[model samples]
Target: MAYRSQIRGEFIRRYSECKAAYLETSWRMIHERDVKHRALNTEFGYPEPDGSFGIGCKSSVDQEYKRRYDEIESRFRKPYDDQLPALHRWALENSMSVYECLLMDDIWDDDLKALAKLSTMEEDWQFQPIIAKARFMVARWKEEHVVGEIQRRVKIESSHFHYAAARCRNLLGLKPWDLAAQKAIFDYGKEWKSALEFAFGSLTAA
Candidate 1:
Protein backbone atom coordinates (compact mmCIF):
# COMPACT_ATOMS: atom_id res chain seq x y z
CA MET A 1 0.00 0.00 0.00
CA ALA A 2 2.85 2.33 0.81
CA TYR A 3 4.25 1.71 -2.63
CA ARG A 4 0.85 2.16 -4.24
CA SER A 5 0.18 5.36 -2.36
CA GLN A 6 3.55 6.63 -3.38
CA ILE A 7 2.72 5.96 -6.99
CA ARG A 8 -0.74 7.57 -6.95
CA GLY A 9 0.08 10.26 -4.45
CA GLU A 10 3.07 11.28 -6.45
CA PHE A 11 1.16 11.37 -9.73
CA ILE A 12 1.14 15.15 -10.01
CA ARG A 13 4.64 15.42 -8.64
CA ARG A 14 5.67 12.63 -10.98
CA TYR A 15 4.68 14.79 -13.92
CA SER A 16 5.85 18.17 -12.62
CA GLU A 17 8.80 17.58 -10.27
CA CYS A 18 12.23 17.32 -11.82
CA LYS A 19 13.65 15.66 -8.71
CA ALA A 20 10.83 13.26 -7.85
CA ALA A 21 12.56 10.13 -6.65
CA TYR A 22 9.50 8.51 -5.12
CA LEU A 23 7.96 7.64 -8.50
CA GLU A 24 11.22 6.13 -9.67
CA THR A 25 11.59 3.96 -6.57
CA SER A 26 7.94 2.99 -6.61
CA TRP A 27 8.22 1.88 -10.25
CA ARG A 28 11.05 -0.48 -9.32
CA MET A 29 8.77 -2.24 -6.84
CA ILE A 30 6.00 -2.46 -9.43
CA HIS A 31 8.34 -4.37 -11.72
CA GLU A 32 8.70 -6.97 -8.99
CA ARG A 33 4.91 -7.24 -8.88
CA ASP A 34 4.92 -7.83 -12.63
CA VAL A 35 7.21 -10.82 -12.20
CA LYS A 36 5.03 -12.27 -9.45
CA HIS A 37 1.76 -11.51 -11.24
CA ARG A 38 2.49 -14.38 -13.62
CA ALA A 39 1.48 -16.81 -10.85
CA LEU A 40 -2.11 -15.65 -10.77
CA ASN A 41 -2.60 -15.93 -14.52
CA THR A 42 -4.48 -19.22 -14.56
CA GLU A 43 -5.93 -19.27 -11.04
CA PHE A 44 -8.64 -16.75 -11.82
CA GLY A 45 -9.77 -18.65 -14.92
CA TYR A 46 -7.89 -16.15 -17.08
CA PRO A 47 -4.46 -14.66 -17.52
CA GLU A 48 -3.02 -11.79 -15.55
CA PRO A 49 -3.97 -8.30 -16.70
CA ASP A 50 -1.36 -6.67 -18.80
CA GLY A 51 0.52 -3.67 -17.30
CA SER A 52 2.08 -2.70 -13.98
CA PHE A 53 0.66 -3.26 -10.50
CA GLY A 54 -1.43 -0.16 -11.04
CA ILE A 55 -3.06 -1.76 -14.06
CA GLY A 56 -2.86 -5.37 -12.82
CA CYS A 57 -5.91 -4.98 -10.59
CA LYS A 58 -9.61 -5.28 -11.52
CA SER A 59 -10.91 -3.52 -14.60
CA SER A 60 -12.80 -1.02 -12.51
CA VAL A 61 -9.50 0.35 -11.33
CA ASP A 62 -8.44 0.37 -14.94
CA GLN A 63 -11.57 2.27 -15.91
CA GLU A 64 -11.15 4.64 -13.02
CA TYR A 65 -7.64 5.37 -14.16
CA LYS A 66 -8.95 5.50 -17.69
CA ARG A 67 -11.28 8.25 -16.61
CA ARG A 68 -8.38 9.99 -14.95
CA TYR A 69 -6.37 9.62 -18.12
CA ASP A 70 -9.25 10.96 -20.15
CA GLU A 71 -9.52 13.89 -17.83
CA ILE A 72 -5.85 14.47 -18.28
CA GLU A 73 -6.31 14.34 -22.01
CA SER A 74 -9.23 16.70 -21.66
CA ARG A 75 -6.78 19.28 -20.50
CA PHE A 76 -6.17 19.54 -24.23
CA ARG A 77 -9.46 18.06 -25.51
CA LYS A 78 -12.38 18.39 -23.18
CA PRO A 79 -15.55 16.60 -24.25
CA TYR A 80 -19.14 17.68 -23.66
CA ASP A 81 -21.21 16.27 -20.78
CA ASP A 82 -23.80 14.91 -23.19
CA GLN A 83 -21.43 12.10 -24.11
CA LEU A 84 -19.96 11.59 -20.67
CA PRO A 85 -22.75 9.44 -19.26
CA ALA A 86 -22.89 7.18 -22.26
CA LEU A 87 -19.17 6.69 -22.17
CA HIS A 88 -19.19 6.16 -18.45
CA ARG A 89 -22.06 3.71 -18.69
CA TRP A 90 -20.31 1.83 -21.45
CA ALA A 91 -17.14 1.69 -19.41
CA LEU A 92 -19.00 0.69 -16.31
CA GLU A 93 -20.74 -2.07 -18.18
CA ASN A 94 -17.59 -3.45 -19.72
CA SER A 95 -15.22 -2.33 -16.98
CA MET A 96 -15.58 -5.73 -15.34
CA SER A 97 -18.33 -7.94 -16.57
CA VAL A 98 -19.43 -10.82 -14.36
CA TYR A 99 -18.49 -12.98 -17.28
CA GLU A 100 -14.93 -11.86 -16.62
CA CYS A 101 -14.85 -9.86 -13.38
CA LEU A 102 -14.97 -10.91 -9.74
CA LEU A 103 -18.11 -12.01 -7.92
CA MET A 104 -18.21 -8.71 -6.09
CA ASP A 105 -17.36 -6.58 -9.07
CA ASP A 106 -19.91 -3.89 -8.29
CA ILE A 107 -18.77 -3.53 -4.71
CA TRP A 108 -15.16 -3.32 -5.74
CA ASP A 109 -15.96 -0.75 -8.42
CA ASP A 110 -17.90 1.40 -6.00
CA ASP A 111 -15.11 1.34 -3.46
CA LEU A 112 -12.50 2.19 -6.05
CA LYS A 113 -14.47 5.04 -7.62
CA ALA A 114 -15.37 6.50 -4.25
CA LEU A 115 -11.75 6.43 -3.25
CA ALA A 116 -10.68 8.04 -6.49
CA LYS A 117 -13.25 10.81 -6.12
CA LEU A 118 -12.22 11.39 -2.52
CA SER A 119 -8.56 11.54 -3.42
CA THR A 120 -9.20 14.00 -6.22
CA MET A 121 -11.37 16.19 -4.03
CA GLU A 122 -8.96 16.03 -1.10
CA GLU A 123 -5.87 16.27 -3.28
CA ASP A 124 -4.10 13.42 -1.46
CA TRP A 125 -4.50 15.17 1.91
CA GLN A 126 -7.57 13.36 3.28
CA PHE A 127 -6.41 9.80 2.82
CA GLN A 128 -8.00 7.12 4.97
CA PRO A 129 -10.25 4.87 2.90
CA ILE A 130 -8.11 5.55 -0.13
CA ILE A 131 -5.21 3.93 1.68
CA ALA A 132 -7.36 1.02 2.76
CA LYS A 133 -8.35 0.04 -0.78
CA ALA A 134 -4.81 0.53 -1.93
CA ARG A 135 -3.59 -1.92 0.68
CA PHE A 136 -6.36 -4.42 0.01
CA MET A 137 -5.74 -4.60 -3.73
CA VAL A 138 -1.97 -4.99 -3.60
CA ALA A 139 -1.92 -7.59 -0.81
CA ARG A 140 -4.72 -9.59 -2.42
CA TRP A 141 -3.23 -9.57 -5.91
CA LYS A 142 0.29 -10.45 -4.76
CA GLU A 143 -1.02 -13.29 -2.60
CA GLU A 144 -2.88 -14.80 -5.54
CA HIS A 145 -0.08 -14.71 -8.11
CA VAL A 146 2.60 -16.34 -5.94
CA VAL A 147 1.32 -19.93 -6.09
CA GLY A 148 0.52 -19.93 -9.78
CA GLU A 149 3.87 -18.45 -10.76
CA ILE A 150 5.69 -21.03 -8.61
CA GLN A 151 3.90 -23.98 -10.19
CA ARG A 152 4.70 -22.72 -13.67
CA ARG A 153 8.26 -21.89 -12.73
CA VAL A 154 9.11 -25.30 -11.23
CA LYS A 155 7.90 -27.26 -14.22
CA ILE A 156 9.92 -25.33 -16.79
CA GLU A 157 13.18 -24.89 -14.79
CA SER A 158 13.33 -27.46 -11.98
CA SER A 159 16.49 -29.59 -12.14
CA HIS A 160 18.74 -31.59 -9.82
CA PHE A 161 21.65 -29.49 -11.01
CA HIS A 162 23.02 -27.04 -8.48
CA TYR A 163 22.16 -23.40 -9.02
CA ALA A 164 23.27 -20.64 -6.69
CA ALA A 165 20.94 -20.82 -3.67
CA ALA A 166 20.78 -17.06 -3.44
CA ARG A 167 20.18 -16.41 -7.14
CA CYS A 168 17.66 -19.27 -7.10
CA ARG A 169 15.96 -17.65 -4.11
CA ASN A 170 13.74 -15.53 -6.36
CA LEU A 171 12.55 -18.70 -8.07
CA LEU A 172 11.45 -20.28 -4.80
CA GLY A 173 8.22 -21.10 -6.54
CA LEU A 174 10.20 -23.49 -8.69
CA LYS A 175 9.67 -26.52 -6.50
CA PRO A 176 10.90 -29.97 -7.49
CA TRP A 177 8.17 -32.61 -7.42
CA ASP A 178 4.78 -33.60 -8.81
CA LEU A 179 3.56 -30.15 -9.70
CA ALA A 180 0.02 -31.50 -9.91
CA ALA A 181 -0.01 -32.99 -6.44
CA GLN A 182 1.73 -29.99 -4.97
CA LYS A 183 -0.75 -27.72 -6.68
CA ALA A 184 -3.65 -29.84 -5.45
CA ILE A 185 -2.76 -29.29 -1.82
CA PHE A 186 -1.84 -25.72 -2.49
CA ASP A 187 -5.03 -25.13 -4.44
CA TYR A 188 -7.15 -25.03 -1.30
CA GLY A 189 -4.87 -22.49 0.30
CA LYS A 190 -4.94 -20.11 -2.69
CA GLU A 191 -2.96 -17.10 -1.51
CA TRP A 192 -1.52 -18.92 1.48
CA LYS A 193 0.16 -21.47 -0.77
CA SER A 194 1.48 -18.62 -2.86
CA ALA A 195 3.05 -16.99 0.18
CA LEU A 196 4.68 -20.29 1.21
CA GLU A 197 6.12 -20.99 -2.21
CA PHE A 198 7.34 -17.42 -2.49
CA ALA A 199 9.14 -17.89 0.81
CA PHE A 200 10.37 -21.50 0.29
CA GLY A 201 11.23 -21.71 -3.40
CA SER A 202 11.25 -24.72 -5.77
CA LEU A 203 9.29 -27.41 -3.90
CA THR A 204 11.25 -30.66 -4.14
CA ALA A 205 10.08 -34.24 -3.81
CA ALA A 206 13.38 -35.33 -2.42
Candidate 2:
Protein backbone atom coordinates (compact mmCIF):
# COMPACT_ATOMS: atom_id res chain seq x y z
CA MET A 1 0.00 0.00 0.00
CA ALA A 2 2.85 2.39 0.81
CA TYR A 3 4.49 1.60 -2.54
CA ARG A 4 1.20 2.19 -4.31
CA SER A 5 0.81 5.56 -2.58
CA GLN A 6 4.36 6.58 -3.58
CA ILE A 7 3.72 5.61 -7.19
CA ARG A 8 0.46 7.58 -7.20
CA GLY A 9 2.24 10.65 -5.83
CA GLU A 10 4.91 10.36 -8.53
CA PHE A 11 2.24 10.09 -11.23
CA ILE A 12 0.50 13.20 -9.91
CA ARG A 13 3.76 15.13 -9.89
CA ARG A 14 4.59 14.05 -13.45
CA TYR A 15 1.13 14.93 -14.66
CA SER A 16 1.43 18.39 -13.11
CA GLU A 17 4.82 18.92 -14.74
CA CYS A 18 3.49 17.89 -18.14
CA LYS A 19 0.47 20.16 -17.78
CA ALA A 20 2.66 23.11 -16.83
CA ALA A 21 4.99 22.48 -19.78
CA TYR A 22 2.08 22.30 -22.19
CA LEU A 23 0.59 25.55 -20.88
CA GLU A 24 3.94 27.34 -21.02
CA THR A 25 4.58 26.22 -24.59
CA SER A 26 1.08 27.14 -25.69
CA TRP A 27 1.21 30.59 -24.06
CA ARG A 28 4.67 31.30 -25.51
CA MET A 29 3.48 30.46 -29.01
CA ILE A 30 0.42 32.67 -28.53
CA HIS A 31 2.44 35.57 -27.12
CA GLU A 32 4.96 35.40 -29.98
CA ARG A 33 2.15 35.40 -32.53
CA ASP A 34 0.51 38.39 -30.81
CA VAL A 35 3.76 40.34 -30.86
CA LYS A 36 4.23 39.62 -34.56
CA HIS A 37 0.63 40.57 -35.29
CA ARG A 38 0.99 43.86 -33.39
CA ALA A 39 4.21 44.71 -35.22
CA LEU A 40 2.58 43.97 -38.57
CA ASN A 41 -0.41 46.07 -37.62
CA THR A 42 1.90 48.97 -36.74
CA GLU A 43 3.63 48.62 -40.08
CA PHE A 44 0.33 48.74 -41.95
CA GLY A 45 -1.15 51.61 -39.89
CA TYR A 46 -3.97 49.64 -38.42
CA PRO A 47 -7.13 51.14 -36.82
CA GLU A 48 -7.98 53.12 -39.90
CA PRO A 49 -11.00 55.42 -39.57
CA ASP A 50 -13.36 52.51 -40.10
CA GLY A 51 -11.27 50.15 -37.91
CA SER A 52 -10.40 47.94 -40.88
CA PHE A 53 -7.71 47.50 -43.49
CA GLY A 54 -7.57 48.74 -47.10
CA ILE A 55 -9.48 51.93 -46.30
CA GLY A 56 -8.58 53.79 -49.44
CA CYS A 57 -7.44 51.02 -51.77
CA LYS A 58 -5.57 47.73 -51.45
CA SER A 59 -2.00 48.92 -51.61
CA SER A 60 0.92 46.51 -51.65
CA VAL A 61 1.61 47.48 -48.03
CA ASP A 62 -1.93 46.54 -47.05
CA GLN A 63 -1.76 43.26 -48.95
CA GLU A 64 1.50 42.28 -47.30
CA TYR A 65 0.17 43.11 -43.86
CA LYS A 66 -3.00 41.13 -44.53
CA ARG A 67 -1.01 38.16 -45.72
CA ARG A 68 1.24 38.19 -42.68
CA TYR A 69 -1.74 38.61 -40.38
CA ASP A 70 -3.51 35.67 -41.97
CA GLU A 71 -0.42 33.50 -41.78
CA ILE A 72 0.14 34.28 -38.12
CA GLU A 73 -3.53 33.75 -37.33
CA SER A 74 -3.51 30.40 -39.08
CA ARG A 75 -0.39 29.34 -37.22
CA PHE A 76 -1.95 30.47 -33.95
CA ARG A 77 -5.09 28.44 -34.58
CA LYS A 78 -3.43 25.27 -35.85
CA PRO A 79 -2.27 24.08 -32.45
CA TYR A 80 -5.68 24.65 -30.91
CA ASP A 81 -7.55 22.99 -33.76
CA ASP A 82 -5.14 20.09 -34.27
CA GLN A 83 -4.04 19.34 -30.75
CA LEU A 84 -7.27 20.12 -28.93
CA PRO A 85 -9.03 16.94 -29.99
CA ALA A 86 -6.22 14.77 -28.70
CA LEU A 87 -6.04 16.85 -25.55
CA HIS A 88 -9.74 16.57 -25.08
CA ARG A 89 -9.54 12.82 -25.55
CA TRP A 90 -6.82 12.61 -22.97
CA ALA A 91 -8.87 14.71 -20.57
CA LEU A 92 -11.88 12.49 -21.08
CA GLU A 93 -9.74 9.41 -20.48
CA ASN A 94 -8.87 10.95 -17.16
CA SER A 95 -12.55 11.65 -16.43
CA MET A 96 -12.01 15.39 -17.02
CA SER A 97 -12.91 17.88 -19.72
CA VAL A 98 -10.59 20.16 -21.66
CA TYR A 99 -12.07 23.12 -19.79
CA GLU A 100 -11.25 21.42 -16.51
CA CYS A 101 -7.71 20.81 -17.67
CA LEU A 102 -7.30 24.44 -18.66
CA LEU A 103 -8.73 25.58 -15.35
CA MET A 104 -6.34 23.29 -13.55
CA ASP A 105 -3.50 24.99 -15.42
CA ASP A 106 -4.67 28.36 -14.00
CA ILE A 107 -5.61 29.81 -17.37
CA TRP A 108 -7.62 33.03 -17.25
CA ASP A 109 -11.30 32.43 -16.79
CA ASP A 110 -12.18 34.54 -19.83
CA ASP A 111 -9.93 32.36 -21.97
CA LEU A 112 -11.58 29.26 -20.58
CA LYS A 113 -14.96 30.76 -21.41
CA ALA A 114 -13.82 31.36 -24.99
CA LEU A 115 -12.44 27.83 -25.21
CA ALA A 116 -15.69 26.48 -23.88
CA LYS A 117 -17.56 28.30 -26.64
CA LEU A 118 -15.11 27.24 -29.34
CA SER A 119 -15.18 23.62 -28.20
CA THR A 120 -19.01 23.64 -27.94
CA MET A 121 -18.53 22.25 -24.46
CA GLU A 122 -21.73 23.97 -23.40
CA GLU A 123 -23.76 20.86 -24.14
CA ASP A 124 -22.48 19.24 -21.01
CA TRP A 125 -24.35 20.00 -17.80
CA GLN A 126 -21.11 19.58 -15.88
CA PHE A 127 -19.54 22.37 -17.93
CA GLN A 128 -22.28 24.88 -17.19
CA PRO A 129 -21.25 25.46 -13.59
CA ILE A 130 -17.66 25.88 -14.65
CA ILE A 131 -18.70 28.49 -17.18
CA ALA A 132 -20.71 30.35 -14.57
CA LYS A 133 -17.78 30.28 -12.20
CA ALA A 134 -15.49 31.49 -14.97
CA ARG A 135 -17.79 34.42 -15.67
CA PHE A 136 -17.79 35.41 -12.01
CA MET A 137 -14.04 35.06 -11.81
CA VAL A 138 -13.57 37.24 -14.89
CA ALA A 139 -15.84 39.94 -13.50
CA ARG A 140 -13.96 39.90 -10.21
CA TRP A 141 -10.64 40.06 -12.03
CA LYS A 142 -11.70 42.97 -14.19
CA GLU A 143 -13.06 44.77 -11.15
CA GLU A 144 -9.80 44.30 -9.32
CA HIS A 145 -7.20 44.74 -12.07
CA VAL A 146 -8.65 46.35 -15.19
CA VAL A 147 -11.10 48.81 -13.69
CA GLY A 148 -8.66 50.32 -11.22
CA GLU A 149 -5.83 50.59 -13.77
CA ILE A 150 -8.05 52.13 -16.41
CA GLN A 151 -9.38 54.62 -13.87
CA ARG A 152 -5.83 55.63 -13.05
CA ARG A 153 -5.04 56.13 -16.73
CA VAL A 154 -8.31 57.80 -17.69
CA LYS A 155 -6.63 61.13 -18.40
CA ILE A 156 -4.02 59.51 -20.64
CA GLU A 157 -6.35 58.84 -23.58
CA SER A 158 -9.90 59.33 -24.70
CA SER A 159 -10.04 55.65 -25.53
CA HIS A 160 -9.01 54.75 -21.99
CA PHE A 161 -11.61 57.08 -20.52
CA HIS A 162 -14.33 55.61 -22.70
CA TYR A 163 -13.19 52.05 -22.04
CA ALA A 164 -13.07 52.53 -18.26
CA ALA A 165 -16.52 54.09 -18.15
CA ALA A 166 -17.88 51.50 -20.52
CA ARG A 167 -16.64 48.71 -18.29
CA CYS A 168 -18.52 50.17 -15.37
CA ARG A 169 -21.63 50.70 -17.45
CA ASN A 170 -21.54 47.26 -19.00
CA LEU A 171 -20.43 45.28 -15.98
CA LEU A 172 -22.33 46.94 -13.21
CA GLY A 173 -25.03 48.56 -15.36
CA LEU A 174 -24.38 51.91 -13.70
CA LYS A 175 -25.52 55.23 -15.06
CA PRO A 176 -23.03 57.25 -17.09
CA TRP A 177 -22.91 60.12 -14.59
CA ASP A 178 -22.18 57.74 -11.74
CA LEU A 179 -19.57 55.86 -13.74
CA ALA A 180 -17.85 59.05 -14.85
CA ALA A 181 -17.93 60.64 -11.42
CA GLN A 182 -16.80 57.55 -9.55
CA LYS A 183 -14.67 55.42 -11.82
CA ALA A 184 -13.28 57.82 -14.46
CA ILE A 185 -12.71 61.28 -12.99
CA PHE A 186 -11.95 62.91 -16.31
CA ASP A 187 -12.67 66.53 -17.18
CA TYR A 188 -14.06 65.94 -20.66
CA GLY A 189 -14.21 68.77 -23.14
CA LYS A 190 -17.24 69.55 -25.29
CA GLU A 191 -16.75 66.82 -27.85
CA TRP A 192 -16.43 63.89 -25.47
CA LYS A 193 -19.15 65.21 -23.20
CA SER A 194 -21.46 65.63 -26.19
CA ALA A 195 -20.61 62.14 -27.39
CA LEU A 196 -21.28 60.67 -23.99
CA GLU A 197 -24.58 62.53 -23.81
CA PHE A 198 -25.57 61.17 -27.19
CA ALA A 199 -24.52 57.66 -26.21
CA PHE A 200 -26.41 57.78 -22.95
CA GLY A 201 -29.43 59.25 -24.71
CA SER A 202 -29.37 56.45 -27.20
CA LEU A 203 -29.05 53.87 -24.49
CA THR A 204 -31.93 55.38 -22.54
CA ALA A 205 -34.02 55.46 -25.70
CA ALA A 206 -33.19 51.90 -26.48
In order of appearance, the predictions have TM-scores of 0.18, 0.34
The segments of candidate 1 whose C-alpha lies over 4 angstroms from its true place after superposition are 1-5, 9-107, 129-131, 134-206
Count of clashing residue pairs in every prediction: 8, 0
Off by over 4 Å in 2: 1-7, 47-63, 80-206
RMSD of each: 22.5, 19.2
Cα displacement (angstroms), candidate 2, residue 74, comes to 0.8
Residues 1-206, model 1: lDDT tens digits: 22223224333222223212333444555454444443333333334355323323333445554454444334423222234344334434433221111111222444444444555666554554323443444344445666566455433322311232222222223354646434432332243233334433422321
Candidate 2 structure quality by residue, lDDT tens digits, 3-55: 11111222233344445556677888877877777667656677556665432
- For model 1 the TM-score comes to 0.18
Rate residue 75 of model 1 by lDDT: 42
